[model samples]
Target: MKIRQLQFFFLAIFFVLILSGCGSSSATKEDKVIKIGATAGPYSDQVTEGIKPLLEDKGYDVEVVEYTDYVQPNLSLDQGDIDANVFQNSLYMKDFAETRGLDIIEAIKVPTAPIAIYSEKHDSIDDVEDGQSIATSNDPVNQARALAMLEDLGWIKLKEGVDPTKASEKDIAEYIKKVEIKPLEPAQLPRAMSDVDYSFVNGNFAISSGLKLNGAVYLEKTPPHYMIGVTVRESDEDAQFVKDIIEAYQSESFKKLNEEDEKYEGYVLPEWMN
Candidate 1:
């Protein structure tokens, strides 16, 4: 009788150990995987080449989800389909969140691509004829930026007291307009150059379309305008994994890759981690 009781107790203990082991295995699988989403171009390339290895070394399984459109990546992140995203800047993200009712926050400022104005009709700003049509982005923030660039170039004068953040063509006070401004979608700006006298193209679209940045008639000044960052849900703001991802992107290896990569040199800089 004593032997049988000991055997029963041992069986019960063994079953409890098996259940505990299963629970631990499930938790480990859940914690090890991290799904990151990014746009399909240079942004995705940078994360894969520059940041993935660091996370893998730290025992995290990093999976990069590639996207083409700007909207889907954030949507995926918000829905918990992705761990995080690194495509847009704070301005774009703010606009997206307000317009879409999202609760995302920036994780780190990575790099900024200078916006440029390209022209097939004119080699330089001096060559642009008075009354010629110049194309700019129609998106509100970018449109304001395009106008600011023009204002800086002495092409037009914005109204006094008009905040740079809230600038619009309607804000132009002077009637001495010599150029016809046409606003178009950011993607279409590059292709519209042949149709218009000049078109302002964002860096990503310009580079992807093979537009040369070096000889552009106008380019956004570097530094502050160069602020682009990774984004995550407000809940993940202080997560250790988020911090690790930021550190990895800001690593020396990644910085070197951004600085020395042939395609990256004139196109982007290594200004990671704000």
Candidate 2:
């Protein structure tokens, strides 16, 4: 009886060891998997259409996760729920990560569409009238860009010596055109077009909502940092997967897609592409 009991115990130990080994191997394989998160739209399309194929060719199992809100992607990335994200510009990502105490960094800048003043009410920017309302994002980074663009168009004047990157409605020193600025969520700007005289629409939101970049009354000449970037945790900076992702964005295939695809029409090409 004792001998039989010893044999059964050793058999159980062997099975447990085998299971443990299998689990360890599965984890090792999973480390090669790359998961990317993006807002549901152009950025997600970028991963599915542009980045995924290239990385898969290199033998990485790539999964793209889509989020609707701006906050969740970074939170997911920070918590290791996703490996990378491809929605936000460098400035916005930097500010967000800093504010949330998340350690993330942009791996590469992607070709981006520029935010623009879209108007259903006017045919051109020259048709501007005083007291008309323009919709803009309430977020500081984007609102600053919109306000600065208005300033550039001679419609608004920001207070002297204010940082243009951080400018807000409160910083408006004068209303050159006396237009009311309506601050809304970035995604809501596209829908607000019919009600407002002009709405500042983010590029991703614009493209996702079936609006064309060329159809805008005015498009921004996007700054380099304002271009959307692929972000990963700072600890992953030296990882092989991160390097592969960077290579994928810089690949000729991606450039060709952007050049030929009607979906990407009027997008501001990154400096590297130019």
- Say which candidate scores most in TM-score: 2
Please give the CA lDDT of all the candidate structures.
0.80, 0.91
Candidate 1 least-lDDT 10 residues = 265-274
Across residues 13-35, which tens digit of lDDT does each residue of candidate 2 receive? 99999999999899879878999
Candidate 1: stretches off by over 4 Å: 1-27, 175-177, 223-226, 267-274
Q: Residue by residue across 143-196, what tens digits does model 1's lDDT show?
A: 888888788888888998897655888998763558999998777888898899
| Full-model lDDT, candidate 2 | 0.91
**Per-prediction TM-score to the true structure, in the order listed:** 0.83, 0.90
Cand. 1 Cα-lDDT: 0.80
